[model samples]
Target: SSDVVAGYLDAKWNWSTLVGKVNSSTWKAHSVLSTTDATKNNLVGVFYNPTTTTKGNKVFLLAGSLGELNRSGVQRKRENLGLKLVVGDVREPTGSEPSGRIDWAEPTSPLNESTKTAHQGNLTEFLAAGGSGVLTEDGTLVFPLMAENGNGDVYSMMIYSTDNGSNWALSEYMTFAKCYNPRITEWEGSLLMIVDCENGQRVYESRDKGRTWTEAFGKLLGVWAKPRLVFWDVSLHLD
Candidate 1:
C-alpha cells in the first residue's frame, strides 16, 4: 500500500537512487495515517533537532551507532530509559561514525516514565529509518517510532516532550500495519511523515506541532526505504 516517494539528494544536488520499498505506518492498525485518528502502539524511531548554541548548529539525536547495546523487545517499554541523545556540530561533515570534526555529546540523561511509550506486544524487534525526531519552532520535541512484535505485527508510536526533554509521553498505537521505516521531516512549517509499503509510501501530516495528525496525500505514492530529507539553510545535509 505504498504511494508517496522521497529520494536522497546526491552530492551534485540531484535526487537519485529513487527506489520504492521504504514507508512507515503510524500505528498498530494496518491502515495509513488518517485525518481523524489518535492513539497508537509500538516503539520504533530515532529523533533529531538542530540545537544551535554559541558554538554552532548542534544536531541532537539518539545515536544508532550503539546498536549493539540497544536491543529490541518488550524490554524496550521499560529499558527505553537507557536510550540517550548524541549531539554533534552541524558544521561538521556527515560520517558513519562520529569523527574529529563532528563530536558526540552522549548525555547521561534518560527518558522518564512520563515520556515512555506504551504499546502492545513485544516491540523487541528493531525497525526504523531516519531520526524521526524534530524540534518545532515552538520548542516542542517529537519522535516517531516503529516497532514489530514476534508474531510479525508491526506497530508505530510517537514519543514527545513539551518542556524540552524535562518529561516525555507516548501516543496510543493505531492499526496502521504493514508499514516499514517511517520517516518524518519538517516542511512548510508542518511535520510530514511518510510510510512505506509494498504498494507505495503513504503520507501524513501533523499541524499544531505534532500533536494530532491528518492524511496529507489523497492517495498512496511509492515504495522507498531509509528515506532522509534535505532541509533548507544547511550546506551539507547529514543523517
Candidate 2:
C-alpha cells in the first residue's frame, strides 16, 4: 500500500486530482514534468529524462524568476536564477508502496567568481534561464546559459567545469535568434542546441562537443509550442 500522509486534507486531494486532469489534456506537455506558481507570476520550472532509460531514470534541473514586487502591479524587480540540481533515485512501483526516493543535491548558492559570475549582473537585471544540460553516455555534464542584460538582447554561452562548477570556464560568445528560452540535449552522440528565434525554433548541432555548432534545422516551428528533441532508445522524441 502507498504510504499516506497523516491528517491529509480532503481539499488537498481534490485539488491535486483536478490539476492532474488538466495536465493530461496535452501529450507534449505531459512527457515533461513541470512546476509553476499558482498565481502564474512567471515562476515556472521543468524536469525530464532526456535519454529515456529502460528504468525510466533521469535527472532534473530547475529555473525560476526572483525579485521584489512594487505596488504598480508591474514586475519592477526580477532576476532569473538557474535551477539547482536535485539528485534522487526513482523506480517503478510494484505494489504502491513508495518504490524509491529520488535524492537531489541540496539547493546551494550560485557559483560566484569575478570573471565568471553566475548571474552576470545585478539580480534584478538578470533572468535565470537554463535547459536540460548535455549528458554524455559515459557520464559528462555540459550546461548552457543565456544572460538577459535587461535590454532587448541576450548573451549566449556555455559553462564548462571539469570539477563541477567549483572551477569554471566560459565558451566563445554566441547569439540566439531572440532573447527567449534556450535548451541543450544530446543527439547522435553530440550536443545540440534549440532556441527560440524570432518566434520560431532553431536547432544547432555541435560535433566537436559544444565547441562549434552547425545549423541542423531552422524555423522548424513556432515558439508558442515547446521545442525539444532527444534520442530515446535509438529513436527521436520531440515536443
Tell me the whole-model lDDT of each prediction, alpha carbons only.
0.45, 0.44
Best by lDDT, which number?
A: 1
Write down the RMSD of candidate 2 (Cα, Å): 10.9
- Model 1: CA > 4 A from native: 1-57, 65-82, 88-103, 107-128, 173-175, 208-211, 219-239
Candidate 1 lDDT tens digits, 2-109: 111122222343233212212323112221111112112432332222122112255445422121123455354321223444444444445762222434443433
lDDT of 2 by residue, 34-62 (tens): 23321135433332222111112644343
Highest TM-score model number? 2
Q: What is the C-alpha RMSD of each candidate to the true structure, in Å?
A: 15.1, 10.9
Q: What TM-score, over all chains together, does every model reach?
A: 0.47, 0.51
TM-score of 1: 0.47
